[model samples]
Target: MENLNNNEYQKFADKKVPKPTYLKNVILAFLVGGAICTIAQGVTNFLESQGYNEDLCGMGTSIVMIFIGSLLTGLGVYDKIGKVGGAGAAVPITGFANSIVAPAMEFKREGFIFGVAAKMFIIAGPVLVYGIGSSIIAGLLSILFKG
Candidate 1:
């Protein structure tokens, strides 16, 4: 009985196999990243074709993508995409928006003030703060250089 148990344990231990090739992972990452960029390019082209200014077109595209991401987050689809696409979906501006919206949605049950309103800017606050700070610093530098 002892020998039989040891054999059984050995068989179970031997059944554990190593994972597949690194090339497969690389290919999948490449495909997902390409798909994300393709989608962004398509949206940008569509926006430009609609006669929007370059800045407006860019902003519109970002807004639309973020909104779509947020919606997907609400519908629990964004997480699925993240799982499949990994860094592909998580590296974009849309992902930033999703990050902001996700926490707010999750905390929505706590009450509007503490939950929705407060959490809405949790992810975006630092970006906004740094954006303004950097702009101000750049403007000061420009003025100093010009003067």
Candidate 2:
């Protein structure tokens, strides 16, 4: 009877939950990333095919993507996509825009000062800092090289 109880305890304690494989996650990430890039490329191609200049096509593609992201965000759809796509959604510029807007939306209820205005840039602060810092460093290096 003691051995039976011991066996039952062991069985309960030794139960294991299976986890998704790393390779499966990696493959899903890759596919989602590729799909996003492909959509961006298609937008560019469509713009060019419609007689837009290359620069305009590029800008339009960016604008369209950001608009789509913002719209999805406003409609609460982008959050769902973000949850599923993870790094795939995050690595794109649209994701950067979403990051900025989403936080602002969330904090909007706390009043404009501490909530909307303050949090508007919260997600983008690091990105802006790094971007400006890199540009300054690059400009300084260019000036030094010229001298």
Candidate 3:
């Protein structure tokens, strides 16, 4: 029996394991993200064509996107998309909905208060906090320097 050093073992394992397709994954992510954004733009355009102003169209688009994300997540379709789409599926508003819903679904057995409700925001709570905090800081700075 021979004892392999760390470097020797790593080399052995490296040869045994196949390399991942990094470029393929990047292209998939790009296509998925671009598709999501394109759909959103289409929704906005459709709304505008219906005689809605830009502001209303934008809000309508956001609402529709969020609803679609939540619906896909609830139906378990978004998980499949995420597994293949990687960051492409994750960089959109639908990804945000998936983040919130995934935890709640996973923890639902522990009761609503402690599990579903509390853990639902585990992924997104920090994002909301910092986002709001930064907006506040930016507003204050603008007021102080520009006002």
Best by lDDT, which number?
3
Error of 1 at 134 (Å): 2.6
Find the 10 residues in a row with the least total lDDT in model 3.
1-10
**Clashing pairs in model 3, backbone N/Cα/C closer than 3 A:** none
lDDT of 3 at 46: 96
Quick one: best TM-score, which candidate? 3
- All candidates: TM-score: 0.69, 0.77, 0.83
- Writing each residue's lDDT as its tens digit, candidate 1 over 1-147 gives 655788788788777867555676666657776776678788999999988889987888788888888888889888787777666667777677777888899889999999998888887788879989999999999999998
Question: For residue 47, what is the lDDT in candidate 1?
Answer: 90
User: How many steric clashes between backbone atoms does each model show?
Assistant: 0, 0, 0
Better of 1 and 3 by lDDT: 3
Cα lDDT tens digits, model 2, 83-129, are 77777887787788789889989999999999989989888899999
* Candidate lDDT (C-alpha), each: 0.81, 0.85, 0.93
C-alpha lDDT of candidate 1 relative to the true structure = 0.81
Residue 40, candidate 2: alpha-carbon lDDT: 90
Screening candidate 2 with a backbone cut-off below 3 angstroms (N, C-alpha, C), the clashing residue pairs are none
